[model samples]
Target: MTTSTPAGHARVAADAPHGPAGGRTALVFSGQGNQWLGMGRDLMAREPSVRAVLETADDVLLGATGWSLLGELAASEGESQLADPAVLQPTLVALQIALAGLLAERGLVADHFVGHSLGEIAAAAAAGALDLPEALHLARLRGELMRKAVGTGRTALLGVDAERAEALIAVYGGGADVAAWNAPEATLVAGDAGTVEAVVAELTGREVFARTLPGDIAFHSRFLEPLRTEFTEAARGLLVPRPTSGRVVSTVTGTLLEGGTDSDYWAANLREPVRFVQAVDTLLELGCRTFVEIGPHPTLGPSLTDCCAHRGVTPLVLPTLRRGEGEQENVLRTLWELRRTGAVRAAAPAGGHRVRFLTAVTAETPPPALRGRQAQFAARAAAKALTALGAAVPGDGAATATVTWDSTDDLAPEAASVVAAPVAPGADTAAVYARTPGTDWLRLATARPGTGTVPTLPDPAELTARCTARRYVADTAVASAAQDADDVLVRLRPGTGTGRRAHLELAVRITAAVLGAHAPIELCDVTGYDDTVAGDRVHVARMADGTARTTVLDAAGRPLLHIARSAWRTRHTAADPVTAPAPAAAGTTEAAALDLDALRAADPATRLTLLTDWVREAAAAMLRTGVDRVPALKPLNRLGVDSVIGLELRRRVAAVFGAEISVVRLLRGATPADLAADLDDWLTDTPDAGPGTAPVCSAPGAVGPGPDLDDPADIERLLDDLDALSPEEVDSLLGRLADDAASEI
Candidate 1:
């Protein structure tokens, strides 16, 4: 297989046998170093099969480790967890197994299975020789044991042939061993720190490129001996490899494992070098023409490609999913390519096949109105459509344009057209449909096709209301109402009663639907008679000005409620919440209130304690509980502190600390403890935080309202910032401005 466009189908050789989904393909699982953040997340969301597999593995790993596997995958942290043997090993296996299961569900089956290092477990599971739960448990134990083993470093040597690579290791390896034969020109070595360094230094002296791999675990070397005994004993109970339809070529032995891979075999697999080249060659010898990496990302693709290249033959190589690319798109693209290649032919499950029918359905009538010709044309078109739909045409009652399907073996067309005989507007076809219960459906357009363009109205968020009741109702109902160009109609649900409040809310909802906004509404002027109840259709006509007049009508067409000039002022200025007055000079009382230098000059530990207390207090305020109720170590979110509350807490923290804190950090930190730790570290490290140092604001986008408010430049700058405020923020700014103006008056 060759690389295709981002959205292009996977490409296979024209002559290859159709692989599984109908093409011949082999599944290869990558070892560690292939996992990354956001891996499999998109796929899990898009594909039900993939989600099922991942969710199942999540439960299994969570049960074994008391941590969520999916959570780790989605976390924003870097490769720290991936470096942990206990975490990375199980996660890699889980990702690979899930990808394999996803493909199988889409009708793709692997002809051969191959895995590198820890990936062997995933491959074994894919071949049906090992149970998933058993594999997960074994992977976790293996990782944990290996982590406990004594080792320090691992490195890969490049630009050296296989012979020279082995010779260099034998000569200067010190205590390190060749861990993996990744490619003919690339070899991985692992051992204690000094030995690994010695090998790298010697290789550099010899002019052969060498670099240390990520993480310090000396996998596949003598360092893992400590794990072998424990791993073997544990595997004896869980590693029960049974017969499988697909073959699993062993990288440890450089050949196929006969009968089945036993517990002892898995134990040794941890300490042996991965002979990936030989395994690839063995798979080719077994007639495998396509190689697909079944993991989060493709780390083995280059190595396997080199292996095939060395054999002087080209093989189809693909990855199940790659970083940055959507998982479902990649799978679908590959499947499309595989179908094109004929390695596998697409086939649907029994009774799941579907056929769809569509018609262009032109509408036209001339003065002549040749009824006979029209009928003949309609019949001919219907027949052609039925043939295209793979549906049987009616013989005796052909005048009805009928299609038929057998209920047992054959099912109805997945898509069927619902057509109605043309009728005048407002024609009551309801009675006719009531009589014939099986009628599919029909739609009637009241206006003629060539009618004048419909007038339009501003969305509900645009206009302001004059009546308070109307405004309140409008704001609440705007989200649920149905509005067209010139009119708005809202169907009150069954629960709203004929009480005074309900009637007022309905009037507001109707008025808001017509005028758009709820604020600045003047509702006290209007008086109501009877209340409106549920099932009433509230209609509002959009007036030329921004305001609207509303009427609530009962089912019988009698007016239930009315409002005169219910909508608000036509040209109201929206509030600007974010705008703030220019800051007074440096010594202003507001600026002096939050003096952080004294706090910073205090002992670091005392400062940290105080800061922690502040966080607790802020969290309590956000949760609307007493400070004693806040959990200092738990994440604030777990205590029902929402975003609004979190923002308020952030504001409080900024005011008290007189330091700018990152909103991102505030949101992403694992818990209050994490936030407190970060703040403490920052305070301790910041040199300017000491006494006698001039204070500076560090909060993002908060350089504002400084002590030089009278300066023209400061005033201009403040206004510029205000211009960037969102509509909600602007509204808040306007409210603050109104309060300040009232104080002055």
Candidate 2:
């Protein structure tokens, strides 16, 4: 059968032997340096298939390392251990495998698979060359071995061809070698730290773009040779040779896997240089045109584009997930792109039997009595109905009950009936349905029997050690002890109110703050709620499954309400377009004209007052709060100004007043009054300077010591820090530095 293809794509026979579009689809997996703290979280909450894969991986990793893989992924930015190779390697592999599984379930199966560096293990698993458990084991062992070599060497990416990279490495010949040939102009060099740094310095001096990769260990180089024997022996016990279901492009050998992967092959994969460009060539030769990157982010898209461009072909490159973007949206977009390009056949609807149940109040139309905890009550009603239908009841162990809210609408309070039915004839999961009295039943939520054991919670003292517990309102509904950015413990105080909606809302707000979720709550799974009392504490921890678990405990610390998962729904609309504001011309606006002469003539006390008022109003605008609410003495972060907001405030200051305030100072407990004092000092010291003059401290004690520019490592660290700043902040900083240098001259 033949089908029409989208414009710019070629049509192909649907029944082709290689694939749905005759070897046009390939799944690419990226290795390290692409992972972030909250990757794969939304998929775990929305896709049951992805959750199952993650759960299986967590089980395998926990048994092997006595640490939960899910726990690490859900860690707060401040508490994250993702930078450690021992943790990151397995985590990336697990996430990649989960993404591949999700894509396959969506009918976007690939005809070929390729992986970069450590990503090959996941690619092998996805290609059916190795079982999931064995693949995870191999990844874990690889990470452990790699961790031992940390700090011994470093890796650097230089904008040069492989030949040029080799020549440069030879110039500083201290064991540095070409690690990976990413593209015609992108080559990775790695070896001893000093040698690599010397090479980077030389290239940088010659204006060639050279950057040191994040991790300290030099992967795919002789620095890893010491680990070969141990890694091979360990891998030998876990990996069994098996044929791949799909063609596996080998980066290490730069060829197709003719037989299969074994212990020695894995050993070579660890130590040998990566021939990524060659692997891309092999895929191109096989006529693969659509590349889907299955990893945390689109780290390989540019390289893939570059490699394809070299062959005079423009391939469609898609990313399964992107850093700081919605995972569900990204994956769905990729799937759509695949179907659009005719690389995957269109999916047919699979109709199935669904069980439904009645509820007192659905999430969409919750009554006043069940306002905030609608999902909790709805799940309870559904579980009872499922039990009546002979479904398995969730036990009070580590296992949990899964609940999802389908819709939201305000309806009159009633004893709303629910229809409970199994998702499949004998499936453990069941769907709950509800409707208004005269309307058809709408799917409300799904309940699934949870597997595995619950994690142990920290002691109350330990949990509250670094946290400041505060009530949601001035003393009204709920008090929460936010432990870092990913965990919160809430205590339901007595005599607050009869309604529990406030408590639930407070918990949701705190959860959103920690998880950085801006979506509305749509579904929640509750467990361990057999009994409860006033003053019971609710502990909510962000999970790797892209949800937060709320565990209610009594004063003595017994579990009362265990909400295993709370899912959020983000509303996307094409009508609501975000357009950037046009840049203002220099000195064109009245606000930009700072009266330097008037400011220099004013007294110190008056200047401080003027600066303080300006700072307060600017902060209020950025914080989206009333100026009255922003106290002059309180720190900006204390008034809900996070790192992102703090950067915006800095940009505003730079744009309007032509002054650069340090973001580190803004977020690290600096008050508006403190900033005003700094501005006053700058005005007093640089009286003859214009508005854009470099910032100067009247007192030497105003700023902290600067980094030593002579030290390359320190310079690198400074540059990394600067990279996090906004473009305006960088411009302001450079202007200030330039003005300072001119004044010295």
Candidate 3:
């Protein structure tokens, strides 16, 4: 099949079967060199009809065959299978055919078909060009014979002039040919490895590398002409079918060849250069818009896109080879997106075969991360969208899927009793081709065409206040309230009022760009609230015990916050506690006035690091700095000689220890978190700890005033809070909250 564009159009369409989502005349299949191990193995297991075809593959190849090519290469670092064309051609074919079968099994049919040289045979089989047996037979003979022509194998060069590569090959190495000029400045050359290496060494200003491959001969280059004649004779024995009634491009010239007998297909392919570049141009001429690479690898995709870029035409390349577990699901999903955007006719799942799915979506078109011509907006969009759907699908065959979102203000939750909440059950397979959900934060825009009742503010805050992952309640309530005001319902767990901080608040920014409004404001804090008890939204608590009253006392008069979130909590226990010791006093009053730096400087290398760190920490204490970025300090109770470390530091201080001038004392004239500023200018400092020590775990992004109480009084208050944590009810609650987070993941 060919791609099409207006006579004077600036961009060309790579040949794809589905053409554009809206077109009728195209056939899509991946090219050679794209196989991975185990690509079609699943299909074979699931569909005996498919397995029948792979069985023939076993008979067609020798050592390291196509069966080993598809996905096995991906197992470890530095392992690849881009070498053998014989294995590559068929291995790629296996997966594409499997995908095609899966698609066809569900009635997603195709029309005209064509493939780059090695892919040509697979395409022919797909388009009735050859039977499975005949295709495999032809491919096997072609691979083995090509292997005989060039002993060490070949490589494809991209972003370089095919002509230049050929010249260098002829001048510096054994005879070689520019086998396939896939695109302008993109070429594939094949010959003896040593010879190809020599030519490559002479070239500069281009990216050139060997693709993973089996040690086989060059199939498309002139070096294989001898085998070509021989293979041509052998191919004559098989009754090659007539080229499909519709036009089919010949890799030899990268253009359509008309009215050729069946044998001519084999003859032309044998003697001609793989004209991938010309084929891409022809497709562009044919008015095709998008190209979907069927299987194995998206071999020609990079080239075709580059080809278009050369003449200023940029198009997308969809490789079926990269699809995950659900092949048909991914293909169908891509088709739907194409249809939604007006590329193809809407091919919705009829029914009964749909998989229920829920997904997190963003309304931001081409979200900030996916920008530019260098990338395929449509392809990336399709990949992202489909993958999300896949994520929300349950492994237990649950027809329902749910999606969560960063913003849920507009999302409305079901009432205490609402039947028939819609579950995600889309047949879109884009998910199969999407990046693993964990690898990237792919956000989708959740804009249903018509709206019933999205979500509102007060309700969301009430819901968020239910989960206390965030330690700020009023903050959570306010943010949740804002979402209510803005009509956004976030996709997350329901709230539970249990937390680490007395109050936990999880807040993020939500801006409305699509509905077009004035400047966007930040929705500060969102708290998880529980509804199990007196119907109150407990905004800032880690969890609510199942046994405890679900009704919260806090939200008696407050509106429910409907933040579209899922709720979970778990249990945790405090480790045994350890006590700290006081710093040692200096020997003499004069010596006690020495600075900490001088004291540390006198220590051996090993002792210096710890003592110096303590001094800086003391400075931070003076500045009242709190909470560390990295979780470096082990819990005091976990250390074997916890007090010893502290004692050693104090002794180091006492050695050249400065005077016991409270950092808080100096801070009366200075600022916080920077003792250097309020650095004692009077008597040298000593390690009794300069004063005003900050508390640990002071929540992220907190900017607040220090305690009004004095040192001993503040310490007493802290100890009291720690003691309060032991209250049976409080312990039970924290236990449940911790449990919730663990349960969710």
Cα RMSD, each candidate: 26.6, 21.3, 24.8
**Backbone clash count, each prediction separately:** 49, 13, 145
Q: What C-alpha lDDT do the candidate models reach, one value each?
A: 0.55, 0.65, 0.40
Q: Which candidate model has the greater TM-score, 1 or 2?
A: 2
Where does model 3 exceed 4 Å of error? Answer: 1-25, 45-91, 105-112, 150-158, 167-174, 192-195, 205-216, 259-261, 323-333, 346-745
Between prediction 2 and prediction 3, which has the larger lDDT? Answer: 2
Worst 10 residues of 3 by lDDT: 569-578
List model 2 lDDT by residue over 1-48, tens digit each: 011111322322233333223357889999888888788787786566
lDDT by residue (99-178, candidate 1, tens digit) is 88766655565678889988989998988888889888878988888767644556555556556655666676457777
In model 2, the worst 10-residue window by lDDT is: 354-363
Estimate candidate 3's alpha-carbon lDDT, on a 0 to 1 scale. Answer: 0.40
> How high is the lDDT of residue 100 in model 3?
58
What is candidate 3's CA lDDT for residue 186?
Answer: 64
Residue range 233-343, candidate 3, lDDT tens digits: 777867644556555655665565464436556766765667776666666666655666667445666776776566555454455534333332234344333332343
Off by over 4 Å in 1: 1-24, 78-80, 205-207, 347-745
